[model samples]
Target: MTKTIVNSWNEWDPLRHVIVGRADDCHIPPAEPALDAKVPEDSDMRGQWGRRPQDTIDRANELLDGFAALLEGRGIRVDRPTPIDHAQPATTPDFHTDSQFGCMPPRDVLLTVGSEILEATMSYRCRWFEYLNYRPLMQRYFEEDPRFRHESAPKPRLTDADYHPDYLSDKIGNAKRLEWAAAKHFVTTEEEPLFDAADVLRFGRDLVVQHGFTTNLKGIEWLRRHFPDHRVHAVNFPGDPYPIHIDATFTPLRPGLILNNPQRRLPDAQRQMFERNGWDIVDAAQPAHNSPPPLCYSSTWLSMNVLVLDPKTVCVEASEVYQMEQMDKLGMNVIPVALRDAYAFGGGLHCCTADVYREGQCEDYFP
Candidate 1:
């Protein structure tokens, strides 16, 4: 029998192989249009631009290493990304930024569907070249699996035309942000195709993508064209003031169940497909912390960013008591992993990892 290298059709299948990110040489990227739009106006990350403090980086690495070990203990194969020099500036002919984002979250860069792992055309100027961190792993996978298809979307220029200047203000209140989100007005424009891998969630034959700061309509259209055989759906959460990734807002635990961030609930119109298909979308538990970790770009909703090991098992942040309890009540075996301290590096459990192989083929659950 031939071994599979990359074949994950959905988020909740029995995970067998994955890639976990590292925090080595991570940096607090300098200010830019798209990056600034995602940072809360009152965030401590404001005005921060440099290599992260050594102690924090070391602690985050420790947590990540332990998480990898925990997964390995469960008989899952875990791979790590090769860290690039994030301190170096990202200079493209269209634009230039002082520094690059870290490789601490592989989920933001790689998207695996079927026997292929696609490198996303990240929207942030600082993250334009972020895919380089995972090239070595992609090479190895390509060599090992005869059927593996390594692909990359067309690289976006990330010019000034890609972002709307109105969102760059430091005083954009939540009310105004919510209003903009309701109107489907986002930071990124329709200049070119752009998307971060984390903005999308695969549901076998369907691809659910979040249309927000990091992914524009053209990007969603690009994905639709790229995956001609898959049904692509665009979703939005009007309550999110700084929407970027879908993992923190909408999580699929199994074929018929999902946990949605209460603060950023999926609008009713977009919920029709799931409701009609008999899937239950319940509100997720409130985050344990009142605020996110220091220098974090994500909101406190990372509590719902749990990684589903299978339909019956999941890994959640160790500090999220309410979230863990909710998972247990939902008939999931929750494995509490110590990773909140590392949230500042990138994100929670689901954010730092990307699926490589899950034990199932694609199935249409919503038909």
Candidate 2:
């Protein structure tokens, strides 16, 4: 009998198995306080809700299927989520929403640290049931991998008390939003341990968590308590007005090198650990476009949200010339994948996937 193997310590390891998301039946969730705060003031996604256009969903699935094939061609095993009906309304005792977010981006729902894949307690009311999309895969992993630890964080009761009403206002300009971010105030209060899996990045012995609109201080604390062996650090980027996940903001390409969004650089004080450990945190190149793709929730920095196939290889969006060139300059074999059209579905290469197995063990890079 073949042994069950599920292990991934950090981001840039030699990946063996992974989960690539699908865009089937994805939805543009209705307006909610947390979701509203993440959307830009003048963005096209504003006032939009319901199932996305079938044409767009088909295009996104084409890209995702092609991406999975590409990874399979590279000797990697890829598993896909069983996407549920996203148009189904999410109703809980604490709150109710017209619909749930899609399973197009599994990284936002599952956090893989070593042998454990934790299902995060997402902050958004619309995304409360998003984890259901990946339950089949998780069940398979559990049945196959005897050592795999499937854990779910404490479910957040996303009542009105969990969010700050001030962020619900559509007229809050970028200046005020920036001011609020700098003040360490976000749309979600410390009502519960609310966090999206994408907010945390695992680095062997250390975990770098983003304290932003999607994750509060309490969420970081919850992660710390959950992983007693890992040193959890809470980081905030004042430059981003609608900060959520950290993948686009801070990308670690390898053990000692990271790419930081030029617009949302990590604060100097937060740079101590990397600097002291001889790691280089360089500013990522400017995105090719000034604005994000239509109806996208992310900023232009999604250009840097690349998937590291290995330490020396990466997959980047085909149209992001500057980002592709930057990866080439950094000595990485860049695989140009067509995914810009799919960005509106969720995000780029990295966001659309989640790690399941990588060939390595936990090693303290900082110590």
Candidate 3:
């Protein structure tokens, strides 16, 4: 049965940590000498592509401390130097930060397979610094050893295939190229896949559960078996392929209140589920053909991506503050966090930070 946090959103709110906002080695893949040289310098790749400069990453980390202080100022108990395991082999370069997305599960005390970082608090070892220094060494080690080589660099996305083919969108081909790379990065594995395995284990097995995905039903069954005590719900349906996680579809704002994209993902049944549960769903669907939902075009930075501070509040990246303010005026408290570099990954506050646990919930299931 799915556990619902209906009525009062405050009842099930969880704690969150914003990345320091600097580019730690963890955000960047081990420097490939050839690729590093080719990577554009001082480029807005972080802005356009969702990446950060090493310095910017450092700044982000510092800012997180200040932000933590600010959160503490509000009387919220901020957790200490919790790190995310960065060594995990990800589906792609972006996956390198899976720990950032998946590490938030243990606060509820158990981990389930496939739950992203947004939902739970992770084990200590899975935290970043545990293996922070190792990344540079690993990159240097790979450089010294000649056998490692990329099999084939992926082909760039065809121009017409883009969601936006007009001159306006075309002008930002580099950003589009990065996004294109991110999609492919999702599909390909690097020289080794074990990197992800080791990454998950670093966090501790209890906090990092894994399951086979022979089939979606089987996958859900696996997640259910492990977290039977918690409410189990599936966010992605057959038709909703783009917004891979629940955060992509429904962003909670203080319990029952949520920011949602009704047109793309929510059908009557799903909407009814919220209504039946007493959720005050805030429909954030796009306005006609003038602007499509960010998910469809893969630009989740605007209002689409954000971080939930509590059931009623959030810390969104600065770029989307305007929309967030609009949400704030609608009754939800929106706190804007700076994630200038992190956006290079094509996500913003929500995309960069994952929730590991909620006060009265069980792990959500994914296939």
Candidate 1, pairs of clashing residues: none
- By lDDT rank, best first, the candidates go 1, 2, 3
Residue-level lDDT tens digits of model 3 in 247-348: 444555553465666543444664565667576766663421233222122334235555556556666555565566666686667676655443333334
Question: What CA RMSD would you report for each candidate?
Answer: 1.3, 1.1, 13.3
Q: Candidate 2, overall lDDT?
A: 0.92
* TM per candidate: 0.98, 0.98, 0.48
Off by over 4 Å in 2: 1-4
Q: How many residue pairs clash in each candidate?
A: 0, 0, 52
Candidate 2, pairs of clashing residues:
none
Cα lDDT, model 3, residue 220: 35
RMSD after Cα superposition, model 1: 1.3
- What is candidate 2's lDDT per residue for 196-269, written digit by digit as tens? 99999989999999999999999999999999999999999999999999999999999899999988989999
